[model samples]
Target: MDLDLALVRAFTTTAGTLHFGRAAEELKTSQQALSKRIARLEELLAVRLFVREGGVRLTEAGERFLPAAHEALAAGGRAVAAVSGAGPAVRIDTWGHLYAPMRTVAQAAQALGPVRLEPGPGRDWPSVAQALLHGGTDLGFGRVHPLPGGRDAGLTQRLVRLEPVDAVVGPDHPLAGADALRPADLREYTLWCPAELTRLDFLRRFADAFGIARRQDGPNLGLDHLVQHLRGDAGCFTLFPADAPLPDHAGLRAVPLVEPVPLYAWSLAWRESARHPLLDTLLRGFTETGRAHRWLDYAPRRDWLPDTDHAKLAEGY
Candidate 1:
């Protein structure tokens, strides 16, 4: 028969207690069952392991085996500790549009050690701030918006770039023909928008200025879902980061939102108390990489969109 961990535990406990009754009590088993287990262990080893003299004692052979049994138990403990002692990994959360930044972080982690990238949670500034403040992440990246009173006082924020926001629509939509759309022009069609709570105050201000009221429509959040609806001719229009790649679908087109509020600044943020060396390395890498690529240039002619290349962002870092 194969060796059993339960039998090993029972034998160790019995050896330590030196009394079958006490060992059974500690193990929450009947004395008869505990005796049977010890007997089975002895039979498996083909040796006399214990003797009941006055109370209970290890036999000559059992005395020699006791240390080996303890060594086996210690080995099991070390195995468990080895698995658990690897330390917790760093977590960074970001919106889906910041795939380039995510790739950069991933490359940095690979060169360093284990790390986790959490994505698609923070759709606006408040959500991003809350994620950092609540220990949900070690760092966060997203477009900047008007900070709530007292929010900026406790955190460190860096404006990385000014990204333009554009209205994305399906090819067959009437406004798809326009080279550029003013906020007033958007009121003529139904605007597919994320829920107000998930949207930043600046985006809400832009919508209000453009006279586009929130519509009660199917699937009120999620860019991918909104794009799917647009593809089906659902009379839907949603805003996207100009630096984000246009969905490869033939049915979609992105037109500039010709208002002053159509532009947003991207920022990387962390709590003031966060002082990890890796965090500093990642920040430096991101800043240097962004500068080298001229990612801050938001000119219409610039083609700096997020892509799936880690080596490209890690070029100078």
Candidate 2:
């Protein structure tokens, strides 16, 4: 019987990870596609290779077939490499182009051998997560929600930074001349945002915690549009990463938030089953850079973080 290499890869990866979702992510295919390939392979062999009980498990036939499958995949990879000369570049995606994480990614890429960066996937982390799981990108960087056992869906994440945040206000705002403002100081002003408060976890939590009385949402056309809104209303303000570059507008000001400075958490996420060769180097670069620049430093009493983030950091994850 002639076996399809694609089918064999699907089986081997699924077998190795014992998780169809993660296997599909690593193979850069949909789970449905991976399942069909496995079923096709079973049909060709006239054997039930797997048993679906409480979860997926391999039958005796599947256990017996695994070693041969591994060998076949290794041979296929060797065959491809023999003609391809060099492997393909690793692909990376990031969101929040105007934030500090983008700069961190750019700096980390310098340590990689050869890589392809696909930027501006979306404005937030969920978009980046979709790209990772759908095989659109090999890796992604952004804020991450804590998942059970540090794995979510078919992806894994590692905390990379706890960046300090700054408040931006109109030049004519009452607090504009203050050297720095605290969360409580802004309680009387409106927290202007581009999305519904329910959709913005960090900002919503901040408002609730600080007893900020009002929040207003509007279209997020771009930085310029948002700045125009801020400038027109002395009672409105917004937040950005401390290192984010603000435009040179005469009426916009970036004011530091102090007395337990709010921090934005940045993370690197990838498919749990992916085994990219350069992933280690890429992560190491972030680690080394973070250490050199004190990117991960957190002072519990002097800094502010989301409760989940604070717990994760305390656990050293």
State TM-scores per candidate: 0.54, 0.70
Global lDDT scores for all candidate models: 0.63, 0.76
Per-residue accuracy of model 1 over 1-317 as CA lDDT, tens digit each: 56776788788788767899999999999999999999899989999888887878888887777645654554554466459985334456676442244544443344444433445455556766765664445677765444658765556666555556788888788888888877677776776655543454445555665677754344344556666777776477877777666557546888886644355555677777643335666666666666665655544333322221112223322
List, residue by residue over 1-317, the lDDT tens digit for candidate 2.
77899898888788767789999999999999999999999999999888877888889998878756755664566467558875545566776554646788877667655554445455566766755654445678877775445335878777888889989999899999989999999988999976655546788778888898899986556777778888999999999998877787547888899997999888888887654556777788878777777888898888998886765574332
lDDT winner among the candidates? 2
Model 2 regions more than 4 Å off: 1-87, 98-100, 146-151, 314-317
Model 2 worst lDDT window (10 residues): 113-122
User: By TM-score, how accurate is candidate 2?
Assistant: 0.70
How close to the true structure is residue 121 of candidate 1, measured as C-alpha lDDT?
54
Task: Please count the clashing residue pairs in each candidate, in the order shown.
Answer: 0, 0
